[model samples]
Target: MKEIIQINLDNEMDLILAHKRCMKIAEMCGMPSSFQTRFSTAVSEVARCAIAKGKNSLLVLGINIIKSTQKEIVAIITDSEDLKSCNPEAFNYAAKISGHIQYNYFDNQFTTTISQQVLSPGLLTETKIKGFIDYFKYEPPLSPYDEIRKKNIELIALSEKLTESENKYKQLANTIPILICVINERNNVLLVNESLENYLEKPLLTFERKTLTHFIHSADIDNVLEGLKRAKQNRSDYIGETRIKKGTNYIWHLVSITPNKAEDGTFNSWLVYFVDINAQKMIVETLKDNTELKMIQLELESANSQLRFKNKELQQFAYIASHDLQEPLRKIMIMLSRAGADLTEDQKKKFYFDRITLAAGRLSNLITDVLNYSRIENSEQYFEEVDLNKVIEEVLGDLSLIIEEKSAVIKVDQLPKVSGLDIQFRQLFYNLINNALKFNSGNPAVTIGYGDIPNDPNFTGSAEKYDVISVEDNGIGMDSSYSGRIFDMFQRLHERDQYGGNGIGLALCRRIIENHNGLINFSSKPGVGTTFWIYLPKNKRS
Candidate 1:
């Protein structure tokens, strides 16, 4: 069997196309006009049924050899849907007209085939069947409502002319360095030179029949179209510069369009040329200014210096305010302790003295966090070689009281020595381990380990290699949505009654990591657990 044409039986257009293709193939097989009409109608009936009831339906026309001296014109319709479900009248009519019909179902697919014996089997030689295949392969499909016969004749003529012209210019176009294009008067590209194809990083088939605006940048399209329109009106040449796309980038090109005329001096087509000008354009842009750039740099430096001075002043003010507030808070705590000694339990409940003490303690913690956050900026000068194992040991000892209360299990892996402030590292681990025990329901489990650093683009540090340490716990985790602002100052995700903190721990942690030229991040789930990953540079910055 030699398949001649295939059409997707999707809509009315495909049904009409299937009918025309069947008739054309039958006529090509030396069948009379009466037989062609009957065969085509038979195929259309099955095709219409397939389009109505089937999924991904297809119609194929082929020539099947029945015997050495016998041949048949065959039409096959295949679909994902079972043909038995379709109206049986379509198949009966096809069988009545074509005299032979078969329906088969296999591998979850349905196929309905119809065949009719050709009038002259010997006329359809092997060479003639091959010619039929080649013709259908290159012939573009036409709509049923279009002037099908007229358009077919026109296309054949145009194909001959294009062949002749391509042969004449193929060598010259490929040999030239400049990009060239030949377009009809209607702006449809007839041919594009090899240079244009190579420059655009695409094939000639992609550019053929497409207008110049297809390859031009969106911002420069209007100007290029206007130039073409004006050239068409004046019947003259056009020269302009625009950006043409090359792969993913658009490069500036100087375009020249010259009108091509016949012997009667009537314009028929256009000869277009493109010269690259991106490098020249960049040079011109770079040489346009220098004094303004220097002035802008100086202004930026001055502004940055003033910003540094203001930040220092703010830090000092915060330190002084927190120091002064602590003294009064300490006095309030002492007075509350002395008064609690004299008051009965019932009297203390009535006066709310215990709540007052708790509030004062929370305020003290807030002041202390503020003081610590301010102190980190000045502590960077105290950088030294710090043993992380020792830091973890100290933090664990400090948190042992709560760990014992919660029955927390602590797992510690071997840690590396890194260049950072020892006190900050100690505080970092203390807060992390304390929170691990504090936030759990009961019987907390905490694991501390170090591993190879991951390649994270968001790590804003100049480290060749990093020591990545992780502190994970089996405690209540936070929502991932709050991850972005978790390190922001005073960002509290839970109410104070639910979780007690000054809402500055993560912010302080981030600041300390910045001082050590490191990064800190965490991942968490609401009921599962939270893990904090710290990336510390192996070497200290000068």
Candidate 2:
């Protein structure tokens, strides 16, 4: 078998492209760069000279055998012109590049053949890049007129083949009565028939570096891409829903892809077609809605009932807040009113000063908690990097007196920097640590640490890159059932006097976390320590 590459060296750019194609083939044949340059340069010289003489020169590159065991790269340049008047320098240059040179003259057509021996294991690795080079061969020598006639025969055959291909393609496209397109391996559009262009009410698309995805609805692009991925990954046919624009409306289509591969089993291209399923889809949806109408009505009724119940709960909450606030105010007012003119200094000091001050402080705390809860969503601020470790330090500083009183050992670990409102983070950590200390046993020990999110059943939500901040304490934990409502406002598991919280601390913590685009969760068993896990997105904000 012989290999050949044909080129019409009619222009300098043609010479260049031909040279590149020739060298690529040489490289594919395992020829070194030096040999590649030799073959490409030799062909360039002959091609340019032939073009200069105003002749339709043809160049063919292929494996030409020399001796019994010797095979070399070869370039055969033929033209229907007199070689006697040609520049001798071109042939000389080709001769120097190639080891062998010959001239064949038959019936007024002249040919220049050049061959060079390749080393052992020559062009050991053949490439699939042959399409980049012209592939043609001539076994029997012919005259200039005969060469032209043979070329004419080839041109006729090529024309017929193209016509046949177009006919078959159109037949397939028209028969479908739907949109269809063909794309190359690189997702470049190779063909689109007339029906598709008319259906889209647009000009036929430029058949290069495009796919059906180019015209697909933007919203469905992700789904189409996923389908393409699955098709390639599984190497199977793919069927998916995509929408195509027709005038102002987008019509649904059931897109189907039939992928093709090379002889070497690599992907080649996909023949994609669409079935207009818009009417059918609408029918299916209409049927489904009618069938489920009863269930939907029932669900709506249930939701309305729940909404009313929640409204009642809100009324109860207001009543409770009002009653609680009145008690504290009433205590202060009664204590002050009792300070009569005959009262002793000791009674006046204890009642008017200490009792009034205690009641006022309790009222202030409750108001502050309610205000913070309401402000979570109303206030807006620019996000910034907040140092978790620094926030922890500030919280500990505020609780310094309590820490000393309880002799609590608060261990701080390395914490991550997170993106959020700075003040919110400080309060969030403060609440968790304060609760841990308040609920601790006599010998209080609290551990604050940072960890990757552990795979726990209680954890929910997804943040790809985040930090898990835990405040674990050796405290008297409550029943597991209370964990669900642990963060509810004014929902206390213990008496207010026992825990010393208005039941707003955990709720405030939950609000702050929500503002930071994070989650707060905790776990504990009765008599065991509690661990509140705060998951904050670890964007590099600092």
Candidate 3:
């Protein structure tokens, strides 16, 4: 070992000294110059590991001529027992000589061994083919003392470089913004940079060998475990959101973990970084919630505006139709009445009298329906406590003459006392009954039934409200298509001669229910029957 040469492995610049000596060794051995690139790379890596792991260790590099035809360069290293703890996998390191070298770890230290032999005459001749043929021939062979002197000088230079580099890296690792840490496979912290002190408010020594969960907030334990599992299962980068305990306060941190793999593709540990994204997360949540609330407010405003406009248009239409057209219609009716009286009995025959009377009767019904429609529009239909049963009895009484005229069998159920306007609600029931009776062309048995649907859809104003009334009839039922259009004003399914109506009955029913903040929907089939459902607010009295 005394004749052998040794150089400390430290820093990139100091690598040139050992590299220059390796080239000389290769030349003296008569190996082709091509081996120079490979030999230099191998030597530099071995030197680095020896110094990095060998805190108090020394690297012993030696070249010996086994034979005149073959030469070997071997590196022997001795370091603290800590080297035994280092992983045995080899790592590739780059050398300044434009080549890559592999490191093979061993007990107590690692070694990089290079072997070279003299080339044939033909290969040596080809080395001059590219450039620099004369320098190879004139160079003096290196003695053993020269190798030692050169190695010692290089070692001294590398020692100084190692000190400078260590200081520089320590400063850099301290100043970095992200919290960098190295954890063992068991999630125990092996090394943590100084940046972590800001978060934990403690020194790096306190974190050593401590489980990562110690600093993680209790609420974030499950999420952190999930992130670890994901990283291990996927063998890729993992991201996790968690709250970390800093002093007595908790702050959100986004942690990222990347697996460190050995050369054999086995899991060794993880390299992690934690970024403070608490502010960003809070901002995003606030913005999202605020945006959703604003959208709801805008929608409500738009709906209310539309409702007001519709009400105004309805009022204007009703006012104009009632007051503007009534005077002219009255004059026409009086003139027609006088003209008919002047005719004699023979002239005022049955056909002429019937036709004129029928026309006048239709005009009168139309005027009455118009007046009712106008009243529904102008009236305030907000709901209050009202007796629906009493309202039904009254409506039936008004239609008593017609019921007897048709000999109709009217069935009434015990109706509920719900909240709704007296006038509008009474009108709703009246129109529904009238429709059932008038449309009874096929069936003679009139069945008027009312009941409450449990768990009724509540009114928007009072979430506990349910519609309390319904009218189902087995009379001349309408098809599904006509059922949808039944609530439209002026929409009639039959001619005036067949059904005496201005088509405002169902429309008025719908308007009254709407004013009470209720829903009016129905289901009907062509040949089956029809059911008109009115959903009233559960707290109609509220």
Candidate 2 to truth, TM = 0.38
| Higher-ranked by TM-score: 1 or 3 | 1
Backbone clash tally (model 3): 4
Residue pairs in collision within model 2:
3-62, 5-61, 29-123, 30-123
Pick out the ten consecutive residues of candidate 2 with the lowest summed lDDT: 132-141
Candidate 1 residue 204 Cα shift, in angstroms, is: 36
Q: Tell me which of candidates 1 and 2 scores higher on TM-score.
A: 1
In order, what lDDT does every prediction score? 0.82, 0.74, 0.65
Candidate 1, 1-542: lDDT as tens digits: 88887677778877877888888888888889999999999889888888888899988889898875899998888899876566798888888988888999888889888898987888888899999999787666564443554466579889999999988778887878888998886576788888898888866453112677679897677667778889999997889998989889999999999998879988888999989999998887688678877886788678667857887788778878887999999999999999899889999999999899999999999888878877876422666788889988888888878888777899999999888778888878887888888788868999998884444334544345677888889888889789888888888888888888977888888878866756787878888898888877666633
What is the lDDT ranking, best to worst?
1, 2, 3
Those runs of model 3 whose alpha carbons end farther than 4 Å from true positions after fitting are: 1-324, 342-361, 377-382, 452-464
lDDT of 3 by residue, 1-542 (tens): 11344555454444565667667655654666777767666655555554555555454545444554443554454555343345233233333333333345666554444444445433333233222223422434355554565567669889999999999998998898878787876576778888886668875444112567778886577567667878888888888887777888887889988998889989878988888988998887677877797897898678667867987898788777766676666676677668778787777674376567667667767877768876764334454678877888898899888788777777767776776678877788888878877888654455555654533333223323564466777777887667557888889998877888888888888777765656777766665666776777565332
Cα displacement (Å) at residue 445, model 2: 0.8
Candidate 1 residue 243 Cα shift, in angstroms, is 28
Please name the candidate that would achieve the greatest lDDT relative to the true structure: 1
Q: List the pairs of residues colliding in candidate 1.
A: none
- Can you write out model 2's per-residue Cα lDDT over 42-85, one digit (the tens) per residue? 87777888888848788877775555456677778788985535
